[model samples]
Target: MSLHPMCGVFVLLSICLISFTTPCYGGNILVFPVDGSHWINMKVLVEELHARGHNITVVRSSNSWYIAEKSPLYTSFTVQIKENLEEFFGKYLKNHLKMEREGASALTFLKLTKDFISMVSEGHFLWCEAISEIFDDPNRVKSLIDAQYDLVLTDPAVSAGVVLAKYLKLPLVLNVRWIPSGEGHFAVAPSPLSYIPVPGSGLTDKMDFMQRIKNLFFHSIIVLQQKFVVGPHYNALCDKYIEGGCDVFSLLQEADIWLFRSDFVFDFPRPTMPNIVYIGGFQCKPAQPLPADLEQFVQSAGEHGVIIMTLGTLVNALPAEVAEEIASVFAKMPQKVIWRHKGERPSTLGNNTLIVDWMPQKDLLGHPQTKVFVAHGGTNGVQEAIYHGVPVLGIPLFFDQYDNLLRLQERGAGKIILLADVNSQTFEQALKEVLHQESYRQNIERLSRLHRDQPIAPMDRAVFWVEYVMRHKGAPHLCTEAYKMPWYSYYCVDVMVFLLSAAAVLLLSTLAIFRFLCCSRKRKTKDKQH
Candidate 1:
C-alpha cells in the first residue's frame, strides 16, 4: 500500500512538469517580415511559433522575393508594392562588386557610398509607400484593428514592421540584427565608438588611435544616413498615422523583446540590454542525413574530406572571371568540393567539384567528413559554422560580411580572403592553410562546446520569451527608459556642468575670505606698533 502511494505521487508530479514545460496555450500573433535573406531567419521563428499552435499572419509585399503568398506555416496578407526590388538589387550588387574589385580609390569609395545611400533611401521609401497604401484602405485598417492580436512580431531591419507594430498598439517583439540606421545595438544599448566598431567600418573591437578615428567617422555617416536618408519616410508615416509622432529608433526601443541573432562566440562582447535575448545559433540544429546521392559523394571523399562553398542566396555567382579563378583553384585540390552557384557554369570546374543551385548547408557543415567551409561570411553561415565546429575559409562580398569573418579570424577560428584580393594563387594558398591547420578546427570546436554548454537550448529560450510577452502583454519593467531621455540627460552632461559651477563658486568664496583675513591681521599689527 505504501509503494502504491509513492508511485501515484511520482506519476502526478510527472504530469504537472510535462504540462508546464511545453507550449500548450495558443495565441494569435501578427508578423511583419523583411524580404530577402532576412526572411530566412524570420521563417525559422515562424515555423517554431506555428508548431506551438499560435495562429500566425504574415504581411508581405505583392512581389516579395522569398516569401510565398500561400503557405502552410501562416496565413498570408498581401499588399501592393510600387516596384519589385529583385531587378534593382541584382544590378546594384553587380555594380557594387565591380567597384569593390576596382580597388579602394577615392573615386571608387565615393561611388560606393553614393550607391549605398541610394539603395537605403529608396528601399525604405518603397516600404513606407506600401505601408501607406495599407493605411489608406479602410477595410484593411478595420481588419487589422479587429484582429485583436496578442503581439506583433517583426524584423526591424526594415522599418515597416516597426512602424506597423507601433500603429497597431500591440506588444512588440523584434527579430533584429540591423535596423534602418545600422547595427541594432547602436539604437538600444551603450556602444562606445572606441571599442564597439561601427558596422561597415571594417575595424575590430581592439583599435589603435587611427582605427578609433575611422570607427567614429563611420558611426557619424550612419547617423547622417539615418537622419537624412532613411528617417524622413518613416517619420512621415508616424506623423500621419500615430497619435503622437515617433521615430524609428524610438519605436525599436519600445519593443518588449529583441531576439538578437548574435552571441559572444561569433561576435565581440558589447553592452546588451535586459530585453535583448541572445539567440545566436537558434536556427542551427544537428545535421540530418544528406540526400542519398549527396551522401554518396561526401562518403567518396574518404581521407581527403570535403569542402563546402556557398555565397548565400543573394548573388547567383561571382563575376565570370572570379568564378573561373575560384573553380580553377578547386580543381587543383584533392578534396571534393560542393559549390552552390546559380549562374553560367564555369569552364574550369573540376571533376572533384559538384556545382548545384543549392546544397544542404547546415547538414554539410555538420558532416564529420567536411574539412573546410568556404562562405560569404553571412550571419547565418558564420553561426552555422560555429555550431558545426567547421573551420571557415571566408570570401566576404558586401555589407557586414567582412566584419562577420573578422570576428572569426580574430579568434583564430577562420581566415578571410578579400574578394578584391582573390586570385588562384591567393585562394589556393588560403585553402591549403585552412585544410592543413589543426588549430582552426580546434578553436571552432571550442566555440561549439561553449555555445552548447548553456543550460537551455537557444531555441527554447527564444520561444519562452515570445510566449512570455504573449502572457504578460509586454515586458516594460525589463526595458530601460533610457531611450526617451535627451542626449544631455542620458549622458549626465547637465549634472557635470552643475557640479563644475558649484566647485568654482566654492573656490572663489574661500579665496576671498583668506584675503580678507590677511588684510585684517596687517591692520591690527600696524595699530599695535603705533
Candidate 2:
C-alpha cells in the first residue's frame, strides 16, 4: 500500500516531532588523559555506560605514553630511581616513620616540580595550544556533534573541549577528576586557602599577613619571569594553538552538571548549586585474589602481616633523606613492609621488607594479610582504602591531600602526620598505632559498608545521569541558575536590597538639606526686620 504524498508529509512531521521531544540514547562522552590515574575510572565508566546501551568514544591523550614509548631508557631510569627510594625509605623509616606522611611530602615535591616543569618546558603548553587550535577552527565541534550523538561529557582538563561545547551550544557534563576546582569554599565555608579570593575581604583575609605578602611577591615574580623568561615561549606555543580568545573558567561555569568522583565519605559539603553532585568512591570494586608472588610474599612474612605503602602515581620519586628515613623505620619493624619507590636506596633491606617500584595497591589492600595503608591521601587511594575497610596513615603533601587526609582522620578512618618533620620513629609510631587500634579498622569498616550500600555503583550512577541528560533535553533540570545572576543577585542583597537602601538614604539627605535652607532664610529675614 503506497502512501499518498499528503500522508507521507504527515508521517515525516510525526517523526521530526518525536525526534525533538523523545530522548536519545545517552550521547558520546569525550574523555581525555592518555593513560594514568584517570584510566581506572574512565575505563570503568565507559564500559558501564556501554553495558547500559550508551555509545562512548574516548579520545585519550597519548602524551605520557608517547614520551615513555619514545624514551624507554628514560622510563626505566625513572622506575629504577623510584624503586631504590622505596627500598631506602622502607628500611630506614621502619622504626616509627609515617609512610603516608612522607608520601605526602614526596607528592608536594612532585607538584612543585610539575609547576616548574610546565614553566620551563613547552610540552603541556604546546598541547594546550594544539587544543586551542582545534577549538578555534570553524565548525569543528558543530560538525562532530552534527555527525552523530547528542550531548558531550568532558573532563575539566580538556579546557578546549569546554570551548567546543560552548561553540556548539550543546549541553555539557563536567566529570570532575577529583575535588571540584572551587570545593575548598564549598566544603569548608570559611576556607583560608583562597586562590581566588571572595569579594570585600580585599584578598586580605584569604591568607595570613605574611603569606598574603609572600603570595603577592611570588605572583609578581612569576608574572615578571613569564614576561621575561616564559611568556615568549608560551606565546609561541599559544600562537600554534589558539587563534581567538577563550575563557576556560567561563566554560566550567557553563557546564550543565559538575559530577564529582567522590562520595559523602570524604568531603560532603551541602550542595550550594543544584548542578554539583558527589559520586565519589564509585570506582572502588570488591577485592579480587592477589597474584601468586604477592600472596607468597605475604605468606612468608607470617602472623603480624604487612603494611602497604604507596605515594600514588604522580609522586614516585622522593628526596634521599626522606627515603632513607623510611628505610630506617622499616628495618626496625617486625611486620613485613612493601614499599613503592622510584629511586636508589643506600640502605640494606631486611628479610621482612619488600621494596618494589610498583604494587597492585588495590589488590594488596584487599589481602587478608594487609593491615593498613600508608598513603599520600589522594582521593582515589583514600577511596580504595576505605572500600577495602582498611585504615590509612595519610601523609598529605599539597593540594587537596591535606584536606582529604584531614577529613579522613576526622572520620576516624585514618590518622595524619605532618610531612615536614616525618622520620622513621614517627612513621613507625603512626603505623603501629593504626595497626593496633581496633577503632581505626572498625570505623573504616563502617564507612566501607556505607560506601558499598549506595543504590548503585558509581559507574552506573554516572552513566545514568549522563543518559538522563539526553532523555531530559540536556538535563536542564540539573543545571544551576546561580551563574545566571550577578554575585549580589545570588544573595538577593546586591541589586534588590542595596539599591533600595541607597535610595532611602538619598531621599532623607535631600529632605534634610531643604528644611535646613528654609529655616536659615526665615531666621535671616526676622533678624533684618528687628
Candidate 3:
C-alpha cells in the first residue's frame, strides 16, 4: 500500500508551498479612534499590527474614513454623527487665537484646568451620542457582535470606546497620545501631587511649596469634576446602551494596558505601574528622500541649515498680524524656512521661505540640515523633533502644549514664547539663540540616542504588548493593586489622619494626668496645714 516516489515528492512540495505562502493568524483587534491627533497618533501602531497578520477594524467618522480605507491592510467602518468634534475644537482654538491677538496673558493654571474639564466633558457627551447612533442601528450592532473581536484599542480621551468594549465583551487598552494626565493618573500608577504636576499646569516635577499647593488645588478640582460631572455623563451612556452602569473613571482603571506616548528621556522621572508602557517615539520613522521641490529649498541654505515651522493640523491659521510678524522673523534669518500654512500666504514671506499647505513633517525633521523646529508644541510635533535631535522654538497655544514647551525649556533643548508675546523681535531672538547655541543641539542629540537606545523600537513594543494581551485574554495579572485601593487609601491620607489623631489623644491624656496629680498634692498639703 506504499505510495509511489513521484506521488510522495508532489505531496511534500505542496505542503512546503502552503507553509511558505499562507498568512500567519493573529487575533482580531478593534480600534475606536477619535479625530485629529488621536487618530494620527495611532496610525503607526495600527499599521504595524496589520503588517504582522492581525485583523484590525477601525470605526471612525466618515470625514476620516479615507485614512483607514487608503490601505487594504485593514477594514474601516464609518458612522454618521450630526455633531462634529473637530468643529467644536476649531471654535475653541479660535477663542484662544482671539485672546492671543488681543494680548491677553497666557491662561493661568487654574483657568487651564477649567478649560480642559469643559473640553473633555463636551467631547464625552458628543462622542457618546455619536457612538450610540452607530450601535442603535440594528445591523451595525449585529455585525459588531458577530465579529467578536479579541481586543479593543482606543484613546481614553473619549469614553465611547469603553461602552463599545462592554457591549462586545472585549478587553480594553488605552493608546494615550500624551503623558498620563489628569484622568489618566487614575488608570496608571498613582502620581503624587506633591511632585507630579497636574496635566496642563505647566509645572515641572521640581516644585516649591507654593507650586505644590497650586498643583494640588488644580488636581483636586479636576478629579472632582471628573467624578461628579463627567463620570455620571458616561455612566448614563453606558446604562442606556449596554444595560450596565459603567463610568469613564472605572473603565480607565480597568484597562489592561496604557500605552503612553512618552519616554523618561523626554519626560521628568516619575513612577509608572507595570501596565503603563512608555512608547514615546512610536510614530517616528527614518526619513525618506524629500520631494524634489522640498529638497531644493532645503538645500538652498547649504551650510546655514533649515528651520521648519508648523502649528499642527488644529492650529492652522494664525492672526494676520501674528503671521506677518513670524514671517518677518524668518526673513531676518540666513536659514531657509519651510512653513506649513493653511490660510492665505503671509504677505511678508521671504524669498528663502517655502509655504506649503502640508508637508511631510517627520521626513523634514529627520533631514541632516534640519536645524530647528518652530512648532505649537503638540505632542506629535515635539516627539518627532526630539526623535530627530532638532531643537524647538515652542509657541504654546493651549492644552498640553504649554506643559510640553515648559519641559523642553527645562531640558535646555528648546525655548518657549507665549503666543501673545510673539512679536517679530522676540521671535527673531529666540530663533537665533536656538540656532546658535551648541548646548541645545548637544542635549537633544544625546536624548535622541537615549530614545533609540532601547532593545526594541517603541512601535514593536506596542505590537508585542497588544498581542500579549490577546494571547493572555485581558492580562489582569499585569494590572497593579493600586487600582483596587480607594484614592484616600492609595495616598495614605487615612493612615496620616489616624496617626495624627492618636498623637493628639496621647498628649491630652498626659496633660490630664499631670493636672490631676497637681490638684491631689495641693489638697493633701492643705489638709496637713489644717
Best by lDDT: 1
CA deviation > 4 Å runs, candidate 3 = 1-25, 63-71, 104-120, 134-138, 178-183, 241-244, 491-530
Candidate 1 lDDT by residue in tens digits, 289-310: 9999999999999999999999
TM-score of each: 0.95, 0.70, 0.86
- TM-score (C-alpha, index-matched) for candidate 1: 0.95
Instruction: For each of the candidates, give the backbone clash count.
Output: 0, 48, 0
Q: Give the runs in model 1 whose Cα sits over 4 Å from its true position.
A: 1-23, 519-530
The residue pairs in collision within model 3 are: none
Give the per-residue Cα lDDT of candidate 3 at 157: 75
Give me the displacement of residue 304 in model 1, in angstroms. Answer: 0.8
Better of 2 and 3 by lDDT: 3
Candidates ranked by lDDT, best first?
1, 3, 2
- Candidate 3 at 256: error in angstroms? 0.7
Q: Lowest lDDT 10-mer window, candidate 1?
A: 99-108
**Candidate 1 colliding pairs:** none
For TM-score, the strongest prediction is 1
Whichever of 1 and 2 has more TM-score, that candidate is 1
Residue 123 shift from truth in candidate 2, angstroms: 6.4
RMSD of each: 2.7, 9.9, 4.6
